[model samples]
Target chain A: MNFNSAAFLVFLPLVVCLYWLLPFRARKYALLMASWFFYMYWNPLLILLLLASTGIDYLCGLGMDRFDGNPGKRKLLLCVSVCMNLGILFFFKYWDFFGECVSGLMAFCGIPYRVPSLNLILPVGISFYTFQTMSYSIDVYRRKCTPEKDFVYFALFVSYFPQLVAGPIERPGDLLPQLKKEHRWRSEDLKAGVRLLLCGFFRKCVVADTCGIYVNRVFDRLLQANALAVAGAGALFCIQMYCDFAGYSEIAAGSARLMGVRLTRNFDRPYLSQSYGEFFRRWHISLNRWFTQYLYIPLGGSRRGLLIRLRNTVIVFALCGLWHGARWTYVLWGLYAAFFVCLESVLEKPAGKITERLNIPLNNPLVIFTRRLYMFLIFIPAALLFRAGSVQEVGQIIQSLLAADFSLTNALGSLGMTSFSIVSLTLTLCAMARIYDFGLYDLPDNGNRTEEAGRQVSGVLMVLVIALCWLALLATEDAAGFAYFQF
Target chain B: MQEWVVLRHPELVLLYGLALLLCLMEKKWKASRGWLFYASCACAAAASAMLILQGADLREAAAYLTVFLLLMPGVRA
Candidate 1:
C-alpha cells in the first residue's frame, strides 16, 4: 500500500506503538512481521521473492566473511549476490521491453526468430529493496561492514516497513545498527517525527496530489491541450514529482524516527539549486549516492580525463534512466539530465571567466534567481519526457510547447486551475520557496531565534495545516498515488 | 482565578494526554526541563488556539482551566 492509503495510515501508528511496546529483543520480530505484512499487503506471493533475495544476500554476506582469506570464493559469492539481485530485477522490470526490442531487430534483418514477451508484474519496491540488499552484500564484500548474523535483523533491514516500499534506500552501515539497538520513547523524537509526518502529509496530500490533477489532465490529452497547457502541465508535473517523491521520503524518515530510529537524509530542497550539478546533488540523494559509490567509482569516475569522465557520466545516467523504468523515454530523460550536467561541468570555467570579464558577480540575487529558474526551466522538458507514454508523446508535448500562447488569460484558462487550486498551490509553492530558498521558516538555520517561538507557533499552525490539507485531499476525488511508487 | 482553553478541546484528548506526559517528564530527563516545558506550553497553546477557533465560551474556558491547572505539578519538576 502507498503512504496515501488509509491502510498505511492505520498500519504505521500501530507498528510504531508496537515497536516501542515490545521488549528490545522481540521488537525485531514484531517489526519484521509488520514489514512482511506491509510488503505482502501489495502482493502476498511477492514476499517470497523479497525473502528469497534477502536470504541469498544474507548467505552471500556470511560466505564473503567466511571465505575472506580465499579471494576466489569471496569473488564468487559477491558475483552470486549481485547477479541474483540484478537478474530478478531485469526479468521482472525489463524482460518485456527488451524482448520487444530484440524481436523488432530480428524482423529488420528478415529473421523469424521471436523473443516471447513475458508480461510480468513487477513486484512493488522490487527495485528499491533489491538495491538495498545488493548494497548489503557489496558492503560486506568490501569489508566496509560485517555480515549481519541474525536473519531477523537482516530481514527487517531489508523490509523495514517505513522504507520497505519507497525508500531513502538505507545502507547496511547506516540502518542495520539502529535496527538492532534498544530505543525508548523520547519526546524529542516523537515531536520531530510528528512534525515530519505533518509536513510530509501536507506536501503529498495537498500540494502534490492537487497539482497532479491538473498535470495528469493536461498530459493525458496532450493532442488537444494548447502550448500553454502542455508547458504549464510540464512545470506542474515538476512540482508534483518533487513533492510526491520528497514527501514520501519525509514520511519514511519521519515514521522511522518515531521509533527513535534515524533514516538517512533523502532530499535537500533540490528545487532551489542554482545549477544542474547542484540540483542532482540534492535530488534523490540516496540513489545518487549508490550510483556514485558502486557504479561511477568502479568505472574510473572523474579520476580519468574529461572525455572519459563525460563517457562515464553518460553511462551512469543512461543506466540511471533505465533504473527508473524500462522505457526509452526514461533513457532519454536520463541523457537529458546528463547533457545539462555535462554542459555545466564543461562550461564551469568558461562561464566563470565570462562572468568575471563582464564584472557580473555570480553571487548576486538576480544572478542566483536566474540560475535557479534556468535549472527549473531545463527540468520541465525532462519532466515531459519522463512522464510520456512514448518518445512520440514527448515530441507532441514539445510541439505544443513551441506553439506558445503568450496571453495570461489563455495560460490560466488552459490550465483550468480553479481559484481553490490557484490559492492552495500558490500557498504551498510559497511555503516551499520560503522553506527551501529563503530559509525564513527554517528551524535549523535560525536555531536560536526559532527555538522558542517557532516550535510553539508550529504546534498551532501545523495542526491547522495538517487538518486543512488532509481535508482537502479527502475532498479531491482524483487523489493519485505517490509518483515514485511506479518505479 | 483564571481560565485555560485546553479542556474545551475534548476532541484533542490525545493532545491533552501528550501534554500531561510532557509535564510529568519535565524534570526526569537529562536535557533541560525548559526543553519539555516549552513542549507542554506549545501543547497548551495549541489546545487554546483550537478551542478558540471552535468558538468556546467562558464556561468552557473555565473547564479547560480546571484541566490545565492540573499541570501545576510541573512547576517544581
Candidate 2:
C-alpha cells in the first residue's frame, strides 16, 4: 500500500498503538499479524508469495543448521534457497522483460520465433523480500548468523512492515537480533520517529511531488519538448527521484524506530557528494552493502587486482541496474555509473596533478564546490537515461538539451513555472534543502545537557513546521507514488 | 489568508523571517529556555502576522491561530 494513502495512514497508527499496549510476549505476534495485514492490504493473494518466501528461507536456514557439519549438504541447501528465491523473483518480476528481450532478438535475427508473454501481475515487494530472505539463507550457510529456529520471528523478520516493501535491505546480523530483543516504550525513540516521519512527509509531498508535476509534464511530451524543457525535466527528475526514494527510506526507518528497531541508514544526502564513487556509498547504502558483502567481495573485490576490481564493479553495477527494473534504460544507467566509477579511478592521480599544477589547494573551497557542480551537471545525462522510456528517448533528450535556446524566458517557461515568484520559491526551497543537508543550521547534539534539551525542543518545532508545510501543500496536491515502488 | 492578500502583504515575509531567525538562533544557542520562549513568540508572531496580512479580520486571524495551535502538540512531542 502507498504510504501516503488513507489506508496506510489508518493502518500504521492502529498497529503501533496496539503494539505498545500489548504484553511483551504477544507483541511479536501482533506485529507479525499487522505486517501481514499491511502487505495483504495491497493484494490478498500476494501474501502467499510472501509466505512462500518466508517458508523457503525458514526451512533452508534450519536445513543449513541440520547439515552444519556436512559442507556439501549445507551448500546444497543454500543453493536450493537461493535458486527458489531467485526463481520466484524471475517468474513474477522479470519474465515479461526476458520475453520481450528474446522476442526482439529473434526479430532482429530475421527469425519468426516469438515467445508468448504471460499476463502475470508483478507482486509488490517481491524483489525486496526475496533478497532479504535470500540473504538470510546465505548468512546462515556462511555461518555468519545462526539460523533462526522460531518460525514466527523468522517470518516477521522477512515481512517486517516498515522496510518490507521499499527496503533499507536489512542484513540478518543487524535486524534479526533486534527482532529477538524485548522492547519497551522509550520517549526518545518516539521523538526521533515523529521527527523523521515529519521530515519524510515534507520531503515527499513538498519536494518530490511538486517536482514530479513538472517532470511528468515535460517528460511525457519528450517528442515535442524544447531543449530547456528536456534539461529542466532531467534536473527536476533527479530531485524527484532522490526525494521520493529517500523519503520512503526515512519513513521506513522512522516507523521501525517507533517499534524500537533500528534499520540501517539508506541515504546520506547523496546529492551533496562530489564524486560518483562517494554517491554510491551514500545512496541506497544498504543495497551497496549487500552487493559488497554477498557479490563484489566474493568476486575478488579490490584485493585481487585493479582490472579484476573493475570487472567486478562493472558486473555488480550492471546487475544492480537490472535489479531496478526490466528496462534497458536502467541497465544503461547502471553501466553509466560503472563507467564513471572506472573513470574516476583512472583519473584520480592525473586530476590531482593537474590541480596541483594549477596551484589549486587540495582542500580549496572553490575546488570542492566546482567538483560538486561538475558532478551534478555530469549526472544530468545519466538521470536523463534513467528517466527515458528507451535508448532512442535518451538520444532525443540529449539532442534537445544540446539544442536548447539561450533565452531565459523560454527556459523558465518550459517547466510551466512561468511566473517569477513560483520559480523563486522553488529555488529557495531547493537552496534551503541544500543548506539543511550541509548542517549549516544544524543544532549541536552532544553538548551541555540544557543545550541538548533546548535543541530537542527546537527539533520538534522544526518537525511541526515541516509537517504544517506538508499538510498545506498536500491539501492542494495529489501525492505521487514512490518511484522505487516498481522495484 | 487569501492568495491575493498573501501575495500583496509582506506579512508572510515577516513570519517566515521570524521562523528562520528562531531556527538559526536555536541552532546557535542550545540551552536557554529563552529560545523556547522565542519559539513560542515566533509562533504567535506568525499567527499575528497572518492575521495582519489578511487585514486583521477576527475570523481570518482565528483560522490562522487555529492551524498554528493545532500544530503545537506535535511540536511539543
Candidate 3:
C-alpha cells in the first residue's frame, strides 16, 4: 500500500505493535505473515509469486549447502537458483518489450506473425525482493554465509515489510543474523525510529508532494510551455524524485530500527557530491554496492586496465538503467550516467592539477558556490530522461529548454498560481534547502556534541513534524502514490 | 510588468541572501548544527509560504533550488 494512504497509516502501527508483542521465535512468523498480507494488499496474485520465489530460494540454499564439498554439484544448484530468480524477473518485467521488438521485426519482413501479449501484471517490488533472495543463495554458494536453517527467519529476512517493497536491499549476512537473535525493543531505538519516520513523512508529504503538483503541470504540457517553464519543470522533477525516494528510505530505515533491525542506508547527500564518482558512491548506495559486488567485481572490475574499467563501468550503468525499467529512455539514462563517469575519470588527474595550480581553496565558499551551480545545471537535463515518459518527450523538453522565449514575466504568468500557492511554494523550497544544507543523512553521526543535542532536538522536532504531516495529509484530498511505485 | 519583476525575483534574491546571511551567522554563533538546521527549515517554510501565496511559478524554481540544496555545501559529504 502507498505510505501516503490512510490504509497504510492504520496498517503500519498495527503491525509494529504486533511485532513487538510477539515472542522472539514467533516474531519472525508474525513478520512473514504481515509481509504476505502487505503484498497481497496490492494483488493476491503477487503473493503466489513471492511464495514461489521464497520456496525456490530456500530449497536452493539448502541444496547448495548439502552438496558443499563437490564443486560441480554446487555450481549446478547455483545455476538453477539463478535461472529461477532471473526467469521470473525476465518474464514479468521484460517479456513485453522483447515481444514488441520481435513483432515489429516480423511486420517489417512481411511475416504475418504477431506476438500475443499476455497482459501480465508486473508484481510490485519484484526486482527488489528477487535480488534480495538471489543474494542469499549466492552468498551460501560462495560460503560467505551459511544457509539459514530456520525457514521462518529466512523468510522474514526476505520479506520484512518495511524495506521489502522499496528496499535498502539488505544482505543475507547483514540481515539474517538479526532475525535469528532475540529482539527486545529499546526505548532509544524506538524513539529514534519514530523520529526518522516523522522526518520522512515531512519530506514526502510536505515537501515532495507539494513540489510534484507543479512539476506534473509543467511536464505534462512541455510542448506549449516557454523555456522558463521547461527549466522549472526539469529542476522540480529532480527535487520531487529525491524527496520521494529518500523519504521512503528514511521511513523504511526508521521503521526497521524500531524493530531493532538496522537496514542499509540508501542515500547520502548525493547532490553535494563534487564529482560524478562521488555522486554514485553517495546516491542509492545499496544499489551501487550491489552492482559493484555482484556485477562490476565479477566482470573483472578495476583489475584490468583503465579502458576496460571504463567499459565495465558503462556496462554496469547500462544494466542499472535497464534494471529500473524496460524502456529505452532508461537505457539512455544509464548511458548518460556512464558518459559522465567516463568523462570524470578521464579528467580527474588534469582537473586536480588545475585546481591545485590555481591555488583555489578546495572548500572555499566561492569555489563551492560555483561548483554547486555547475552541478545543478548538469544534473537537471540528465535527469529529464528518467522522468519523461518517452524518448520523444525528453527530446521535446530539451528542445524547449533551448528555445528563445525566455521572459521571466511570461514564465510566472503561465503557472497560473494563486497567491496561497506562491507562498506555499516558496516555503517548501526554503525548507528543502535547509534540510539539504544541514546534511540530513549525517544526523545518525553528527559528532558528540550534536548527538547529545540531537537526541532532545530531534525527538521534539520529530514528534512535531509527524503530527503536522499527519494533519496535513488528513486535510488534503488524497495521498499520491510514490513516484517510484511504477518501477 | 516591472513591478512584478521587482516583487518576485527580488524576493527570491532576498531569501537567498538571508540564507547566506544565516550561514555566516552560523559560523560565528557556535550553535549546534541541529539548531542551525531548524532555523534554516523555518526560513524555508517562510519562503515556501510566500511563494505559495504569491502564486509564483515554483515547480522549476523549486526543482533548481532542490538540486542546489542537494549538491551544495550543506549537503556535501
- Report the lDDT tens digits of candidate 1 across residue range B1-77: 12333454566667757766775565344244246656765676576557656664322332332233323321110
Best by TM-score: 2
**Distance from true location, Cα of A385 in model 2, Å:** 1.5
Query: lDDT by residue for model 3 over A391-468, one digit each (tens)?
Result: 899888878878868887666655545555676567666656555423233344446443344344333443444344
State the lDDT of candidate 1 residue by residue for A264-380, as single tens digits: 888887878999889988999999999999999999999898888899899999999999999999999999999988998899889889999999988899999999999899999
In model 3, which regions exceed 4 Å deviation?
A109-112, A413-419, A436-478, B1-77
Interface RMSD of 1: 13.7
lDDT of 2 by residue, A182-254 (tens): 9989987786676676567656765677677778777777766788778777888888888788888878977
Span of ten consecutive residues with least summed lDDT in model 2 chain A: A435-444
For DockQ, the strongest prediction is 2
Give residue B25's error in model 3 in angstroms.
Answer: 18
Instruction: Give the candidate order by descending TM-score.
Output: 2, 1, 3
lDDT of each: 0.77, 0.75, 0.74
Q: Score the docking of each candidate (DockQ).
A: 0.03, 0.13, 0.10
